[model samples]
Target chain A: MPTTDADTTFRFLGCSEIQEILGKQAVDERQLAELLEEVPLDSVYYHTHSYFLRSRFIERTYPNDFAQWVAQQLQDHVLAERLSVVDPFDFQSLEALREELISLIDDHLSGMRTVPRATFGTPFYFNRSRILEVPTGIEVQTLREFRDAISDVDSSAIYFHVFEAHLRLQREENDFSAWFRGSLKLPDLADRMKALNPYLGSLERLRSNMLTMCDEQLAKSGRG
Target chain B: MIRELEQYREVAPKGTIDFLYRLSDLVQDKRFLHISAVRYGGGMVEILRRIVPIMKAMGIEARWEVIAGTQEFTDVTRRITDGLQGREETITNEMYQTYLDVNARNAKVLNLDADLVFVHDPQPAALVDHRKGGKWVWRCHLDAGLPHRPVWSLFRRHVLKYDAAVFSLPGFAQRLPIPKFLLYPSIDPLTEKNRELSRAEITQVLDQFGIARGKPILLQVASFDRFKDQIGTIRAYRMAKKHHHCQLVLAGSGVAHDPEGEAVLAEVQQAAENDPDIHILQLPPEADREINALQRGATIVVQKALKEGFGVSVSEAMWKGKPVIGGTAGGVSTQIVDEATGFIVHSVEGAAFRIRYLLSNPSVMSRMGAMAKEHVRRNFLITRHLSDYFTILKILSSE
Candidate 1:
C-alpha cells in the first residue's frame, strides 16, 4: 500500500508465511526428515497445496528424492493444464494473454458460451467466411432506450459500453463501403485497443478497410 | 521526472549508455504498451507512471493502459491471483466465466495495438485477446514459480499464445513455445524512497510519528498481509529483547484487492498487545514520506516477508544506507547480500542474530549500512531497470 511510485515496486512476502509453507523451522536434517515422514507422502494436493512445499519450502527439507517427487508432480499435473497454473513464468507475457483473450470473443460469437477450458486451450476459432450476424435498427434504437433507462449509480457502464461499441461496429457492417470510406477512431473505445489492434477477422481485410478509409479521409482534404 | 532520471547519474558509470544509442540505431519504431489492473496502484502502475513518459522521451512510442473492469472483474481476478500465488481457493464455474466474461468485455474495448505489449501481473492478462498486431509479452510480477493449478490453468489458456514472457527471476519462469526474459524489479532511487532526505526532514517525520530516534527502532514498511510476516517481525523483536531494548514498527497500508490485509492487521495487533514498543500502523496508500521517515528514523530496517516477489522496501532502505535484515525468501535475497549488504536470514533467530549484531556494533551497523546502499545503487535503481526493459524491447524488436 505504500505509494509514491517507487515504494510499490517490489512484491513483498514475509517470513512467517514461508515458515508456514515449509513448516516451522525444520529443526535439522534429522528433524526435517522426521517431519517429512509424518507428512504422509502419498497424499494428493492441488497445485497451490503442492507448491507450498515445492516452491518456497524445498530448501527447508532435504532437497533430494522427496523434492524430486514434488517437482515432477508440479511439472506434470499443475503446469500442463490448458488453463494457466503457477504465477506467470517467462512465457507468460501480456502480449500472449491479449491474443488469447481475443479468441474468447470469437468463441462467444460462436455457439460456445462456456468458460475457457483450462485443458482445452483457446475455445474460439475465427474464419473470414464466418461473419457475425448484426442486430438490426430496432435493437440499436432499442439499446439507446435501454441506455436511457438506467441510473448512474448502478454498475452498467461496461454493459452499456459493450452494447454501444457493438452497435457502432454492427452499424459499420450495414454500410460497409461507406463505413470503410469513413475514419473509425472508436473514441468511446478505450485507447488500449487502438494499441492492441486485435485479430478481428483477417489482417488483409482490416488493411483494405484502413486503406479505403484513408483514401476517403484524404478526399475530404482534397488529397485523395 | 527528468530530474529523477538525473539522479541515476549519481551512481552509474560514466558514458555507459552507448548501448542504448547503439540499440536505437538498430531499432525500428515499435510501440511500447503496458497493461495491468488498477492503473493508479501496485508495482506495475508505479513503474509505468515514471517509465512510460521517459520511454516517450527516449523516442519509443510508449503508453500505459489499465484493462478496464468492474468490481466483479477485480474480485474474481484477485481470487485468481491468490490461487495462482499458491493460495488454496475454490475456483467455481461462475468465477471462471466471470473472469472470461470480464476479459471479453475488455477485449471489446482495450486498445492493445502496440508492437510490444507488456502485461503486468495476472489481472488484465487476458487483455491480450484484444491484441491486434503486436508481439505480446506477459510481464509477470507475482511469484508464479509455483501456483495453484485451477487458476493457472485458467490463465494458461491465454498464456501460451504470447510471443514471449518476462519474469522477475529465472526460477519464476514457465516453459513455453515463446522465449522469456529474467528481469529484477527496481526502485527509483531519487524518489522519496531513495532520494536524499535532509536530516531535519527525517527528524520532522520521526517527531510527527513520535518514533524516538534516541531509542533503537526496527521498522518494516510493507502491506498489512500475512505474506509480509508482520507477526513474525514482532516475535523476533521480542526474542531479541532478551539482550537489548528496541521498538518494532510494523508500518503498512491496506491494499484494496487484498481481502486478507485487515485480518492480518488484526492478528498482528493481537500479537503486539502487551508490547508498547510495537507500533502496528496501517497508513494510507500514498504513505511514502511517512515510510521514508520511518526507515530514515530506524536503526535497523527489517523486511520480514515470508514470501516476496521482491522487497523494494529493503532496496529503499538500502538506498537510504540502512542495514536491512530480511528473510531469504523470494527476491529479498536478490537485494540482501548476506552479511555483506545486511543479512539474508531465515528465521526470527537469524533476524534476531543480525538485528542484535547491528544494535551491538555501531561500526558493523554503519559499515553494513554503507554496503547495503552501494548494493542498491549498483543493482536496484530505476535506471538499471530501464536498461533491463530496453534489453527486452531490443531483443523483441530485433526478432
Candidate 2:
C-alpha cells in the first residue's frame, strides 16, 4: 500500500510483531532478512528477554560487542566509524547506548515497510480489547482483522490513555482486574490479561506478550 | 520599599494583611539574617529585596547579606548548582576546597549572630559550619532530590548541621535529619514585575522589543541555563510554528553568580538564528516593568525547564493572568495544576502539542489563564509566603 499520513507502517512494530509479520507469506523473505540484520543486536536481545543483569551485562560489558555487531551485521559504515571513536573504558550507560542504537535503527527504517523498535508507555495489549471495542459475539478472525479494525487510532495515544487510567486507578484501588473486567465487559479476556501480571512485568515485556497473544490467536484461526 | 502592609490589603484577600500582622506580633523582637550569593538578578534576590523590607516593616529586625566570591568561586558554585539539579558534573577536590575557603571567609566577615540565620542555596550552605551561635536554617531553592553524589556528599555534611531545612516543594526535600519545612516561593503582587500594567505600558514595551501584536505570542522567560532547556524551547517553537502562526519570545538575563549563562545564551542565539519569529531578548537586570509588560502581553507563557527551583517566573506570569506550560520539574508542578491553570509537560513534543492545543482553543486558553491568576493569587502571592515564614518562625522559636 502507498504510504500516507495515516500510515502505521512508519511507526515502530514491537519485536514480537516483527517476528509474526516476518513469518507471514505476504512479507518478502529478503526484506525480512535485511530488516533483522539492520536492527541493533542489543535491542533484539533486550526485547526477547524478560530479565537480565542490566548494569553488569548491557552497559558495563556490551559496547564492544554492540559496535562489532553493528559493523558486521548492520553494515552501516557511518555508524561503525562513529562507534570506533568511542572508548570502551568510558562509562556510557546502557540506556544511553540503547537509545543511540534505536535512533540509528529508526533513521535506517524511516521509509521502510515496518520499523522494529521499542517505545515507552503501556503497550496496546492490555488496552487493545478496551480501545478497539469489538462488537459483542463477533469473534476477531485474525490479527490482520484486529490490526485493520483500529489502524486509524494512534497507538501512542491509546498507550497514554491506558497508562493514565491505570495510574489513576492505582492511586485509588490497587487491583485493575476488576476495572478491566468492568470496562471491557469481557471477564475471560480480563482474566487472561491479569494472568500476564501487568504490574510485575516491564513495559517492554507487557507489549511483547500482548503482540504475541495477537499472533497466537491469528495463527489458531488458520490465517497465518 | 512599599512601607505600609495595609497597601497590600487592597490587592490581597481580606484578613491576609491582618494575619501577617498577627504573625509579626508573635515574633515581635526577633532578628533574622538572610545570606545568599548575589544581590541582583535571579528570583532569590528579587524575592529577598521585597521580603526583607516587608519583614522589617512588621517590627522585626531583618537583614539581607550577599556573600563575597571570586570568578573561580562563582564558577565552581555554578557547577555545584547544576550538580544539585540532577546533572552529573565532576567537582574536583580543589574546587571543593576553594568553595569552603570562600564560605569560611564570608562567615568571618558577615554577621552570623542573630536569632535565626537563613542560608539560601548551596553557595553559602557551608556557613553553618562556621556558625558561632543561634539556630541556623538552610533554605534550599534548588531540586536536590537526585543530586550528583560527590557534590551532594559535600553539601550534606554542611546541611546536616543546620537546625532546620526549608524546601520549596516536598519533592525537593531530601532525607534530612533536621526538621524539614515546605515553603513555596512567592511573587510580590505590588512589585513592578507583578503589578497590573496599563495597556499603553504593555504596548510600549512590546513596541520597544519590536514584538508584533498581530499574532499570538508564546513566551518563555528564564535565565540561559542548560537545565532551563532553552534549546528545547526553541525546538518546540519550531514544531508549533509548523501548525500555527505565532511568535516566540525567549527573554532573560544571566546573573553574576552563574558562569554558564553566557555560553547557554550563545547556544540559544545560535539555535534561534535566521528565525525572525523567535525574538531572543537578553534584557537588562532592571527590566522589571518590561518583564511585567511582556508577561501581560503574552498569549501563553512557558517555562520548559528540565530542572527548576520553584520557578518564580511561572508565578509571575501566572499572576499576570497568563496560562503557563511548565515542565514537570522541581516546584513548577506545585504552581501549575495540570489541565486547570496550566499543563505539565515532559518533552519538547509534549510542549509543542500543548502550544498547538492552546493556540487552537483561545477560549480554553483564556479560561486557563483566569484560573492561573486565581491559583497564583491564593497560593503563590507574597502574603501567603509571609504567613508561612511567620508560621515557621513560630515553630522555630518554640523549638
Candidate 3:
C-alpha cells in the first residue's frame, strides 16, 4: 500500500494530552546549569522517546541492544510493506488529507475511546459564574417568521449536511475510534466562521438556533 | 533630549523600553511565572527572551520555565495542539495517558507559588493541578472557537480551573465561567530581527538566499510546519505570479518538538516545482535578525496557516510596515483587517487575487502597509501586553 493524503493532517496540542503520556524527567537547577555549561551555545538538549520516532531513529537510542531486537524481528517485519499517505510535497493532496482528517475527527466520539478519567476544572481560576446565557428562540408560532429569520441561515443548512456527515462517521463503533468523536472541529471552525462576521450577526443566529434545535430535540426525546 | 523616543512613534518618549521602569513599579511586589514545553523554540520563546530581561531590568520578579517531560510528553502535546486547532488526531488511550503522566510529573516540580502563574498555551495547562499560592491564567494563543471535542474536553478540564483566561483576540477567547482578557502578543522592536538593517546586509542576505527582490516578492515568514500551510502559500504565489510576476520566499525554522517540519518543508518544495523564485528556506532557529530582514525586504507578507494561533508573523510584518494578506483562519483574520490592513483569504485563489490586487497598485499597498503598522502599534505591543498582565495580577491579588 502506498501512502495517501488522508494520513497527515494536524491535530492540536493541549495540556491534558501532555499530562497523560509524556514520560517524567527530573530537572534540577544544578543539572540544567551543568548541561548549560557542557552544551554548546544556541543548542538546547532535547530527549525524545523511541515510540514517537518515525521508527528509523529507534536504533540511535538503544544502540547495541536494539540491533539484536531488529535482527530478531526482521524475519517477521516486512519493511517493503510500509505505506505513507501524508506526503509533505503535495499541496492539493495535503488539503485532501486535511479534509479526510477533518471528516475523521468530526466522526469521533468520546464514548468509543477507553480514555481514563482525569481531574476536571480549568487550570486557572474557576469560571463558575455565568456569563450571558441567552436561550435562543426558534420555536416561533408561524413559518413566515421562521422563514424570515432562517433566510439568513439557509446557506448554513449546507454546512449542516457536512457537519452531520462528520458526526455520523464518528458515531460508528467498529470504525477508527479516534475519528468517531462528535463535531470535534467546532472550535477552529468557529474561528473561521468569525471571519464571516462581515455578513453581520446572521451566523451567530444560526449557531444559536442550531444549538436550540439540538436542545429542543433532546427535550422532546427527554434526553436533556 | 527625547531623541531615542523620536525613533519610535509607537511608544512614549525614550521608547517603551523605559516603560519597563513603570512596569517594574507596578509589579514591584509580584512574582510572575510562565510554563511551556520548550524554552528555546517558536514565538513563545521569542517573546519570553526579550520580555524577561526587560522585566528584570524593571526590578520585577519574573521567571520562565519549561515543563519537564519525555519524548512522549512532547508527542502528546503536539497531538493536542493539532486537536485544538481542529486537526483530526487518532488519539488513542495511550495518547491520553502520555498527556496525563507528563502533566503530573511537571506539576510536582513547578512552583505554582507565584502571585501569578501565566500558563502559556495547552502544553503545560494542567500544571494548575499543583495548588500553590498564585492564581493561574491560561494564555491561549490558539483559536479555541472550534476545538476537537475530546482534545478540547481534555483542555477545558484545565481551562475551567483558571482565575481568568487570556487570548490574542475575542473570537479566540472561549465562553467560559472565567472572564477572558484580550492581549495582542508583540515582537520586540529592539530585537536583532526588528532592528534597523543596512541595505547592504539585507542585500547580502537576499543574494545568499538567491532571492532577487527587485521583482515583486510575496512571502510568508513562519516555521515550516504543516499548519502554516506552506504549500498553499506556494500555490497562491504561483497564481499571483502568473499575472504579477512576483516571487515567494517561504522562510522559517523547524521547532524542537515539531516532528513534521521536514515533511512539510519538502511538500512546500514540491509545490514550488523547482521555481527559482520560490525560496523555501530552513534557517537557523535563533536567526531572528534574518527573519526581520526577510520581512523588511519583502513587498508583501502572508501567513497561510490552515489554522493559526495569534500569528506573530502578521504583527511582525505589519510592524515592518509591509502590506499583508493572511489566512482566514484563527488569529490571522483578526490581524488583517481585510481590504484595509490587508486581505484575509480562505483559499489559494483568494490569496492570489489579493496578492495581485496589492501588486497592481503600489500606492494602495503602501497605504495598507502604513495602516497595518499603525494597527499593530496600537493593538500589539509589549506595553499593551504588560498592562494586561498588570491588571490581571491586580485582580487576582484582590481576590
Best by TM-score: 1
Worst 10 residues of 2 chain B by lDDT: B13-22
- Ranking under lDDT, best-scoring first? 2, 1, 3
What is the C-alpha local distance difference test score of candidate 1?
0.57
DockQ of each: 0.01, 0.01, 0.01
Weakest lDDT window of 10 consecutive positions for candidate 1 chain B: B13-22
TM-score of chain A of 1: 0.19
lDDT of 1 by residue, B62-145 (tens): 888777777877788889888878887777898778877887888787777887888888787777766788689888887786
Question: Where does the lowest 10-residue lDDT sum fall in candidate 3 chain A?
Answer: A13-22
Q: Over the stretch B111-226, how does candidate 3's per-residue lDDT look in tens digits?
A: 66788888898888887866577788888888776678887877787888888787765556556787566566776666677777899888888888888868987878887777
Q: Which stretches of model 2 miss by more than 4 angstroms?
A: A1-224, B69-79, B86-109, B238-243, B254-273
Off by over 4 Å in 3: A1-224, B1-24, B88-109, B173-175, B224-232, B254-267
Candidate 1 segments exceeding 4 Å error: A1-224, B1-4, B11-13, B16-28, B254-260
Query: For residues B1-399, could you state the per-residue lDDT of candidate 2 as single tens digits?
Result: 235667787777443464466457677778888999988876668778878888888888889998999998999999999898777888999999999999999989998887888899999988888998778999888878678887788779988999988777655666777667656788888878888888999999999999999999999988778888989999998999999999999998854566688888888989988688999898888889989999999999999997677788898898888889988666776677667788877799999999999999999999989878877776678877776666565556656
Determine the backbone clash count of candidate 3: 62
